[model samples]
Target: MAPQGVAIIGGGIFVKEEHLPAVLACPQLSLKAIWSRSIKSAQETAKLIPGDASTSVDLYSSDSGEGKSFDDVLKRPDITGLIMALPITEQPAYIEKALAAGKHVLAEKPIAKDVETAKQLIAKAQKIAAETKATLSIAENFRFVQGYSYGAEQVKQLGKVTGFVVRISWSMQTDNKYLNTAWRAKPEYQGGMLLDAGVHFTSALRKLLGPENAVDSVIAQTSLIQSYLPPVDSINAILKTKSNVVGSFIFSVGTTLSAFDFLIACENGSVQAEGSRVVTTRGAGQNATKEEKTFEKSNGVKEEVSAWAESMASGTPNPQQAPEMALADLELLEGMLTSGDKDGARQKLELQHHV
Candidate 1:
């Protein structure tokens, strides 16, 4: 099949750095257009596109006085899909518009600002998708990372899961590019940085635990350590999966501490992942054997984009990038923040979807 003609709909930091590179690198996709809220930003981002794509790609801006606009691009016959990474609160409307225009979409997560908004958007999008025969895939690139995928398979082979622990700590400095974004710095949304960054860890952990062992409940305590990070930036939670496997999740983006690890212990053995490396140990004591695998340059952004292009080409959505999965990730993060707000009151997850 000919490459699917698609457009990059946002001109923000992530769109310029990650999404643009990944979309340009995907052979199954053709860069037909680039749109930003401003024409100047759109043109600047287009410069990053090399060779033929730089000339072939059209530019549209929402603020333009001419006919060149996002809606105009959507009306074009050549563009059949959209890959977008907009501010969390500004995404749902764009998603609805794309689906209504009968274009497939690959949108960045946490799906929406919260579960209720996500549910409403998803329900409407699903109906439109069914009628238009188009697809909507929420991008949670952590689901495609090498270490997490390897660890997940190891979990299946390691027998009954006993428990797990996830530790993530890093300071989002004032100079941090992501933190510099206005939406992130002020964050009108709930859980602030906790909601924005927490979904990534949640997706990875859920990927390792698999569907049958999805997180069912959480009791957490959250706090804002740095004054600039807004509502909250740290969370410590105890989680229980549907299979009775218990685990602890601790994430803090406002601290000076810089450590990250996800460990799953099973009856026969255990799997541990730190960044791009995954280690598995089997057997006991002197007989215990350990093997470690390291992945380089495997952030999964390109892989996830390529998967979305393939799914769009084949007219089927990849379950790994399903909206429901994104919803589950958001639910877990929201549950943690909700429980934290209630002084560690337990919160149950009812909208979680498994794959």
Candidate 2:
């Protein structure tokens, strides 16, 4: 099928840092245009899109101020969906506009800084989608990454999966440019590193395992590691899914190593994927053996963009009922944090729209 014509609606670190590279690299999706308030960003986005005058994508300004902006791009005949990677707070208005314009959408995580906004956006997106029949996807790219994909696939292959475990710990150097302490450290934009990273883990777990999962009423602790940015440093939690499965989450911005891996233990077998490959151990006791499932590094951004294209053309979603990933993950983060509060209470998460 032909690739969907996509327009990205943000500039700055996320667009330049992650989205730009991915969009440039993706084969199934074409960077038709970009909307950043800055002309410099507009030029940068235009340069990255793959085309000449015949194929050039119109770059738009995301600023929506006194200057030219994406508001004009949304009215164009060629654009279909808007890929949003804007700050957590600045998302809802754009999402609503995109949906109203009969355009599809794919947004970054923590759809909104808070759940109420998430609900509003999701409900609005759904309403527009039902009426307009367009696609609305979340840019939850971590799920497309090989390591997480393999780990989740193993859980499916192994019957009667009982539990899931994941550890996403990375000690980002203070000077890590990607993680600007100024923007990310600020709670409103970053929502802490977990909101940024941990959401990926929770989204992965729910999709790979089951959203019916919750931290057992019995055991689980949510521990905050640092305060670099309000609620952006780190957190750890042990959870149990309704399937009677137990999963542990160890995520920290203060990790000594750049460790981000998920291990799922099942009744028949267990799988572990680190850095690149997903390995499985079969049988029980010392007799058990280990085998790994390896796949080429996924062109995740490309695949994700392509998926959005196909969904728009096909009018069907792959992981049906999977709520907007970024929004749901943020809700899960909220629940985890609230449960992790000093009272030591059980948190309820309902994000598993489809298991």
Candidate 3:
């Protein structure tokens, strides 16, 4: 299959530092262009690419090619797909435009603010698949992370996935001096911390447990405005699925330590991942066994790019963390916030699941 030419929109810090390098490392994909919309962003990212690159007005074609806007980037004749890393509020519009342009898309998580918008995006994605056979995927990199990928194997050998737990937390060292004016702190931009960071836990939940599974019930507590930022500081929830699968999750960004993303509780065994280290236990109390699996820290962005490139090239979508998974997670997140135990009343999972 021919290499799919990808264009990355938004030259944000995450995309430039994390994703751009990943796209460059993927042998199957070639970055055709980029659209940052700022001279500073365009120029800053221009230095990261290795070929004969140049800066333009927030939009640039790789290898010293012509410049274009976000719309132009989607409409370009040579491009095959778009890699979106824009703010959550800005995501749907671009995804819609890209789909309308008949291009396959890979976007960041939390498809939209509410369940209905997410459903709209999902419908659009389905229409794209039905009409053009192109599809949309989310960059839930945690599922593709080296540690979690290997941990799943241990869970399989231990037995069936009966239950699970996840604690995903990270510390931000941003200067508060400019935070008030920053778009990140605003709900409109970042979609709150859970949508931004906790999303990893939700997506990983689908991966660690299983996709096509919806939350039958959930109990949650979210602390946001009371924190340093104008948004919620962190969220804690206990989720139960229709399959009677139960799990606890804590997704937080305003914290001290910057690690620990997962724990998978299986029937006969349990597995936990602290960064790259994974420890697995097997059997009952009398004949219990445990082993730790060590994996190297890989270039995550590269792996994601390779996977996306393969999907676009082969016209086949990988099952893990597919479109349905993203939607399920979004529904879970919405239910989480709405299901708060603040009023001492059990909240129902009101969002509908397509799966």
Candidate whose lDDT is highest: 1
Each candidate structure's TM-score, on Cα atoms with residue i matched to residue i, is 0.97, 0.86, 0.85
Task: Give the Cα error of residue 109 in candidate 2, in Å.
Answer: 1.8
Q: By TM-score, who's the top model here?
A: 1
RMSD of each: 1.2, 3.1, 3.9
lDDT of each residue in 1-355, candidate 2, tens digit only: 6666778887766676667676666666666777876667777766654456325756566453543576787777677778887766777788888878888888776667777778887888788878877666777766677676667667777777777667777776667775673557565643466676667677766666644443333233454455554554666666766676766777777667577677778888887876368788888899998997777776366567656666677778756324555656676667766766644476776654544
Off by over 4 Å in 3: 51-67, 160-163, 173-181, 189-191, 211-214, 256-261, 341-344, 349-355
- In candidate 2 the C-alpha lDDT for residue 12 amounts to 67
Model 1 local distance difference test score: 0.90
List the pairs of residues colliding in candidate 1. none
Q: Which residue pairs of candidate 3 clash?
A: 36-58, 37-58, 224-232, 224-233
Error of 1 at 142 (Å): 0.7
Two-way TM-score contest, 1 vs 2, winner: 1
User: How good is model 3 by TM-score?
Assistant: 0.85
For model 1, residues 29-88, the per-residue Cα lDDT tens digits are 889999999899899999988786599899999888677998998998999899988899
Ranking by lDDT: 1, 3, 2
Error of 1 at 104 (Å): 0.4
